[model samples]
Target: MLDPLRLAVGTLTALPVSPPGRIDRRVAGRAMLLAPIAVVPLAVVAGVVLWAGHALGLPSLAVAGVAVGAVALGSRGLHLDGLADTADGLGASYDRERALDIMRRGDSGPTGVATLVLVLIVQCGAMAVAGPATGAAAVLAGRCVLSLCCARGVPSARPEGLGATVAGSVRIPLAVLVFLLAAGLSCLLPGLPWWRGPVAVAVAYAAAGLLLWRCTRRLGGITGDVLGACVETATAAALLALA
Candidate 1:
């Protein structure tokens, strides 16, 4: 359990932790499933930022931006880079090799830059309207998609890299169970309409599913970048629905 937790924290956040001694499918699967729990500290940071902003009478937009930035920093901006790379890959060309090559270059292009800007705007703006609790929920919602992405049978786009290591690591049942748990918890969060939490989650999943389908068709399968892209996409959709 501690090994899985350590793997999750080490991979998902910039927080310091001892690396797991072994990383097999079992450990990776458990780590992905534990993604939401692992990100709790980062979520708390976001919540605190929002709460502090409100208490200090700071501009909601500015505070929300800061909170989003804080999470990006906490996670080492891996998701944001993934989002950009995925966008670049999808927009680059229909040829799978060409698209993958573009993503491999590790530099943002016009399409990637534009996508990042638009997504960040959506995230920050949505956070401003959603308040502290919902904002934190949004953060967890982002990581929850990691389980779904790694569910058994989801192939990797490449033979190596983070995506290949974790791809198809999680069982489908386990992924569904995590989704249900996340939905239930979201619904139970205080101060929001009962429907809001579940609806937000549903929307996030729907958006992520669409992106996954597109990536499977376009890039051949999920990559590390694709997983990151899903995280950002789900986070934004969840926040928007909550707002």
Candidate 2:
């Protein structure tokens, strides 16, 4: 069995994993199982940093902004790249295949840049308005929802993309269990209402479902970048709704 902790950390961080050991199919499958488990600490660290900055009379907004950006770097540009790629893909006026092709390219077009800027601006503003506790809850809940997509949704426009490697490998029940546990933890955080966590989770899932449906119609499946965009979009939406 793969070490759940290593799998979780490896998935969350951009660290290089030794080939064969890290890229083993079994390890990838197990990573899907462990990714949600990894999100909790990332959320906690973000929350604590923002909360501490607030309590210390630092500009909470600035502190939270920097903290969010800092954590994003640690994730090795995963979701942000997703955001950019998805934007380019969706914004393209070409056919679906051509759009997907555009996304596969490493270059970012105007749409991708705009989408990234917009998402960051909205997230930063929402976090500033909602304060640390609520922002943390929203972010954590959003990530849990994203992890569910990776665990459950069909991946990729092809049979061999990153999405396909892990698609449907995650047990549905395990995803639910992790989500519930994360929601409970979010509620336990000071100053956050229990209802807020569930509500945010619900919203995030609903939004993800809509995106999944749309993607399916357009590309016949979800790509890793699509999953990233879903999380980023859902997180921003949840935070904005709470704010």
Candidate 3:
């Protein structure tokens, strides 16, 4: 468990967690179960950054930007990079091979740049208007979607990579449990309008479902990049629900 926890924290964030000498798919798979636990502190750090910016007499928009920067710094912008790559992959060509090649190029295309800009703008606007509670809920909701993307029977886009290692790592029951816990947490976010949490969570799930179907068909399976895109897309969906 410690190895997996370390893997989860280390792989997902810039946090220093000494990884094992050898990492196998099983370790990566089991780590997905504990991914949310690692995300707890990440979300708290972002929330505190937002709070601090507000306390320092910053405007809501500025505070939202700072909070976004804080989370990106903490996580080393890996998810954001994933979002960019996924968009580039999906947009470069409808053909799976060409799209995957573009993603592997690791350079942002017009579509990737445009998608990232839109996502960031939307996220910042939502956080500015909705405040910290909504941010917290969105974080929780975003982490929950990872469980769905990595659940049993989900195929990996690459034969050997993070996607292959973690995909199908989680059992159906555990995946369902984690996702439900996230949805319930969304419904219980403190200081939020009662309607905000449920609506956000529901919309997040719907958005994820759509992504899963589309990506599976187009990419032939989910990839690490797709999961990253899912986090951002679903986070925006959840936050927009609050808005």
Candidate 3, residue 67: the lDDT equals 79
Candidate 3 residue pairs that clash: none
TM-score of candidate 2 relative to the true fold: 0.85
Cα RMSD for candidate 3?
1.6
Q: Each model's C-alpha lDDT?
A: 0.93, 0.71, 0.81
How many pairs of residues in model 2 come into backbone collision? 1
Kindly list the per-residue Cα lDDT of model 2 for residues 57-111, writing each as its tens digit: 8875688687678658767778889889988988895488888888889689999
- TM-score versus the correct structure, for each prediction: 0.98, 0.85, 0.93
lDDT of 3 at 240: 81
- Superposition error at 206 for model 1 (Å): 0.8
Per-residue error at 13 for model 3, in Å?
0.7
- The root-mean-square deviation over C-alpha atoms between each candidate and the true structure, in angstroms, is 0.7, 2.7, 1.6
